[model samples]
Target: MRDGTDHGDQMSDVKKGLLPGQLIWLWLTGVVIALDQITKHMVVARFDLYERLEVMPFFNLTLAYNPGAAFSFLADAGGWQRWFFTAIALGASVVILIWLARLTAAEKLQGVALALILGGALGNFYDRLVLGHVVDFLDFYWGNSHFPAFNIADTAITIGAGLILLDMFLGAGNGAEKKEARKKHD
Candidate 1:
């Protein structure tokens, strides 16, 4: 049999410039955005503003809009919030794209976080640009207590942020991994 050089050359041929593993995260991002928009479209078609359809004891489908940040922060502030939030989301999307391009194949956790964030940002950005507000439909409640209505985009962002926090707390970054390796070696 030949030496390992054959395998190295084959790998180099397969990985011209872009890595397949890196692009997989971008595909997941696309799926997230597609799901977010499709669900939002369904909500808009089936529900009117403030209209609620109880889906379960603790959940409902409600159509609502927010022209501001998370939990409707600055939602009441004049129309400037729309542009402000859009700009933020756009900037975030660009940053996430660059970040994703830089991630290595093994940084799956970070990749997932960035993709989720990018997908969510694009989803909301689309609404803000075309509708002047973010469409929210998912409603969770118990008795009289209720959580704010949110859409898939919001869910993605929240989950992405949570994953980022989890990564930080777990010390899964490159520095931490290297530290662990050194400790094991010593």
Candidate 2:
């Protein structure tokens, strides 16, 4: 009934349809994609493919390109798989961005997770479609055991995946709506 209260409710209703934070999330996601691509470009230009530069006892920066999925799986499939992977990434990115656009700004962590995934997906998709492979550089190992060379994009995607999993397990009841519903019932 009050003026300020009505305005606040209107703002809340507007946010329920399309939150401002989602745009911020989109921008951040674009930044991540840019950073990932630029870093990969630098690595490709600076180092020869598969050239390892040991920076730490267990860490190495190198240039490696993978045509397939994680741990180089299906990398030797006669090169037709690059386009396949690119299509998959592009499709996934579309779905993620659409979902992000519909999500509320208050779902910060979930939005962040989705944005990271979107950026990472597009980053790798760019590489696969443009260069026919995904450029990787960060490497870690302990003697004979190696943990596979990966890049910033891959790391972001991995973290995003973890966050998605965490949200699935924790976000359900802990979400704002559920809390509000509980309060109303109480």
Candidate 3:
């Protein structure tokens, strides 16, 4: 019961496929990368390597470099960890970029979230590789206790992870195949 005209039209649509949401996601990834780099550059230029500028009752702009992973894991490992971490990050970024290019337009939020994480990961990855450490600023404290200092890239990764978790829970119904599965499960 298929017509030649319908088949040709369907093929043409596939060839020209792209939704607005996809464009937004791509743009979001770029924005996160640019913001992360710009802020890091500002922090590096304005602040001495490890100088602190007390800003408020419980916050400061302190320049510090992390030699290891979160909370400075293996930071005192005599510096071998830096190269290892950088290699891991570079590998992960490569995989993520490839994934982003292959994603369809309808999977906007998911793609965007992934892109943000990827960008942030690469941003830190670059620092860790080139500087042998990741920069830390934006210090917060509760009396003597302090939360770890972090940057915009870290924020983007955290937010992206949260959005991805939300998307999975809310059933975004991004693609025809996914929608069918969701409907079946529901």
Tell me, by lDDT, which candidate is best: 1
lDDT of each prediction vs. the true structure? 0.83, 0.81, 0.75
Looking at model 3, residue 183 earns an lDDT score of 49
Pull out the clashing pairs in model 1.
Answer: none
Which runs in model 3 stand beyond 4 Å of their true positions? 1-26, 172-186
Give the poorly placed runs of model 1, Cα more than 4 Å off.
1-19, 172-186
Model 3 / residue 139 / CA error / Å: 1.1
Candidate 3 lDDT over 5-33, as tens digits, reads 56554444433432443355556767887
lDDT of 1 by residue, 95-155 (tens): 7876666555556787899889889999999999999999999999889999988989888
Where is model 2 more than 4 Å wrong at Cα? 1-19, 175-186
What's the alpha carbon RMSD for model 1? 9.0
List, in order, the clash count of every candidate structure.
0, 0, 0
Residue 31, candidate 2: Cα error in Å is 1.5
**How many pairs of residues collide in model 3?**
0
